[model samples]
Target: MSEVWAERQRRTNQLVRGIARKVLEGPIDGNRLYGLCRLTWITEAYDAEHPAYIRSTKIPALGDALHQNFTGRTLDEVANEVATQLERPELETLVRSHTGFTNFYKAYRNSAREWMLMHEAEITAIFQRAYLLQSDADAQLLGADIAALPSIPKANHPHLLMRPEYLLTPACFALDPRLRFPILNGAERVQSVLRRIGAADRSVPAQIQLFVGLIGQNGVRDAADLDQLGLTALDGLGRADHEPMRQLLMHVPDEGDSLPLKDEEDVRRLQQALDVAQRRVHNSMTNKLRQLLANWTLLEGRAKDCRYDVLVKGYDGGDNDLLLEVKSSVDSAQIRMAIGQVYDYWHRLMGPSSDCHAAIVLPGRPDTATEELLQWLEVGLLWLEGGQLYTSTEWLEEFVAAVGPKK
Candidate 1:
């Protein structure tokens, strides 16, 4: 069993190195390639551990390192720093003996060197072609060719070879679909072929190990009993938060499978964290707006099953009220959702009255298309720029006029 596991590890490393080499040979910049490799290693190593271990021990240490050294630094620079730190005898000993991997550092270096040597000719040829074409389409075609390679192991799944969860590849790919690589496409589609193989011949334990690494023990009972999990808010959060939920969900064996209840709960916890972060930003914007509208009455809009972050009523004692939906950043989806939500709240509280104007308030302005959409919907747009709140629509102007000019 150990021998089989060792061989599985070797084959997986081979595939990863092959894909990495292909990318290296392509027109991709150094920063991106370094980022890809760094994330791949982190995910491969970290996912292999128990979730409890990660949450309790790994996260604190990792978080500190990230907060201290990784903040505002490029991944390539961070990778170098991490490599330098790990080379210290004391740190290396502490990591190897305590973490899930047994002699992980040594094994990783040895396997990487071995794979590079073994795939030198293939890697060279791929690089040559990549340089000759220098087009993303050509790189993608090369990936397809690599996926079709007859010498590659057919039974082993690509998900195991490249754990997408750790590298943020799935989320990055989703945000900019152009980031698609042949290796990723292969990994995503391998399960279909794997289904045809005999259950006995299939590497169920390997699959289980990869699953355990990606999702943690709480998400699954055993390797054989696995379900699909979706990381919602991937698209919404992808722009602001580079590390996305899709990265966390990429390790699921099948894309179609449903997540267990535990995984769903974990996702809920993540959503709550995001809400808190956004609220912090919203609060800052609210405070600034409140100061500006000192004479006008500012009240929180509350309704059954819904709540508005802020509502501004004019000092003129008229029915004219401004319903503001505050967001940290107004992406297209957020604006769309906010528009519907504002209408729902207004109709429930005020009941179909033109006396109230709905506006989407954001920390930053949205794109021209999103701005146009807001105008068409008759939803006013307000944003903060250079430490001042600015408005684009006539409704906002009326609301500001009621409060009078800045002191």
Candidate 2:
């Protein structure tokens, strides 16, 4: 048996590694994938009889083969375990030091896109650039067009596939396994997250109003939901024309060491206001979706894939089925879950079932880490037969609008 501290550290390491693994390679289509990848790396040998692993004699245990054929303990486990060991206070240290992929992937985000160009270094450039290009359509004004997005020339840098500020399509990226990286390197990921979940804006706060022109057009119950949106969900890349304002509300906890205000009520009032505002946005977003989707199918439900989170899927006839993933999310896990659902949606649509083609929609970009949650899975940027992932704002203005707004 291992030392108690070592055992504790090992478990924590496993937890972190496991989450990162899911972020890089999940939607866990079949349990076989999970057993093969996740359980195989442990110190204990595989039972081989586990249903998830051996569905049939023909199915090779990629997990088992990996453990036996590969040398040394896997980095997926090693990097995380090492950090737990090296960091003092052991498990507690690891918990605090460890960051989920949602926060880490932003290092890859080009500055200022995910967060309205908030980076200190690029704030100046973003301001200048936004000024030069008043509208994304003003591309001609600056003699700049969206050049073909640069593809990842190397592995472990999938976020690089998504350019900043400018919008992205799923085809713009790939979901190859060679992109996998060690999950334990949180420090390295900081830069990646910053690059991918940036802080620049194409237009100022007022430009969000364009979406409002449709408030009455679509019978939006409470336009306040759009008002409540914080613009952060579309943090990495989007246009001001359609990004819902709910994408912008970020309630950062005050990290200051000193509480200068003597009145606690002041803080409470401020928080109360924010909560009410966010809730209105939340409700409005759901109501608007429900209103927009009443005719097709139920607008509220899980992806039939990841039920623990908010996801909606509907049956549409022909190649045009509908599936939506709802994430009141501020991170990339939403992206990963949406990716998995889209893959499954494709399979369900054209694979075994004869359902309509579907749409995999989300309220925002996934904050989940691509290095771990989306590993080994062939999840590209778009769905099979050309489906899309969108925030509530984008869905209302672009994809859903394609079908026309609710009367």
Candidate 3:
């Protein structure tokens, strides 16, 4: 057999086995399966209901339009082809005319890259345990394993961990409606896809290794190294041993994807963290807003990750909605690095309908240094602690009352 045909057979075998294990694992939820599809195929095969639901849970307008005007077969039965898997019509409509897919792809891809780095829990251990056979692997093998894994490539620069440049092409996938699978408990199904693909379990292919090295090299422009990014070169790849391919394998959706909150306790914990952050910002900012009608809101990171110590609000909200972005750290090298995060939030906040303001909650007394940063914010500075946000005594009762128990 020719080299191309042989490679195709190998990939077909891997995909078949992968799909088999995924099926044995259980019938995946439509949404989770849609996420997996984003990696495996071109189109993300979500029906009106799923995307509508996702939009509601995340963005109401996105959900509403998703409720309308999206009906395609998603499959070409005769030829077995899938189309428009990564493209969301409603979402595309919202941003396409403005920034177009080029910008959207860049932003989404960047977001995914940052997210993978954030969930850097015992990815190695998870891979080793479930897949087995990782025992006593030497440095080269371990490096190969890291390089081989597609989702998170261990870059040539070990210190940088998984660099973003290694992300695979056709970087998104949708669902295949023709196949019947169980609806996941939301992102759980996506996570399962990561595990099954050996990305979660640390299995990877060769492309990811090169991709990692390439990304690690920053932006080297050597012709030979860059030649592998074309569509034809990607045709036979199924994430068997490619480094960039592993990223495609493991890049599942995480936002607002959680199993049902099992009990009141779970709800309360989520509420407490949310409430503490909310009230602290509110009380601290009310006075500042009084100075200027700084339109603002807040966005926090997943409470679990420790990359950033705190969340803060800055002025750049949409004309109406407050735009807040989280800063992972404040002590970076650049003078404006931390402040720029706070600054960007303010810029996004100043929408057609509102004015932008800003603030950063320092873990310590940012007194003199932070004061200098405040000149950049429309909303003046204030410290964050229990007493400042509200009466020291009223905090618990107020926080709980403001944040009631879940239904």
Clash number for model 1? 3
Displacement of the residue 272 alpha carbon in candidate 3, Å: 27
| TM-scores of the candidates in the order shown | 0.32, 0.21, 0.21
Per-residue lDDT, model 1, residue 213, is 39
What digit string (tens of lDDT, one per residue) describes model 1 on residues 1-407? 11222222333233233333334444544233323233223224343343343333333333332333344544344335544544433332223222321111222322333343455455345434533443445544554444333232112331223322212222122122222221221232224323322222333333322323322322222111122221121111213333221221112111222322212222243353245455456566766666565444455532224456556644336656677777656666566667877887677657877755788888887889888888888888888776666777765676555544544
Ranking of predictions according to lDDT: 1, 2, 3
Per-residue C-alpha lDDT of model 3 across residues 18-127, encoded as one tens digit per residue? 33233224332322222322232211322233333222121221112122222332112201211132232332332211110111122243344344445433222322
What TM-score does model 3 achieve against the real structure? Answer: 0.21
Candidate 3 RMSD to the real structure: 20.5
lDDT winner among the candidates? 1
Put down candidate 2 lDDT per residue, 1-407, tens digits, no spaces: 01122223234333333333332232333222222222212222213233222222112222221222223434344434434443423423433232211121333433313232223233222223322333423322221212222322212544545332122110010111111111111223223423332412223122222333322321122222222122222221234344221221112223333322211232233343234444343344444454344333232221232222112232223224344433233335445445655555456434765532333333344334542343334332211112222333322334444444334
Ranking 1 against 2 by lDDT, winner: 1
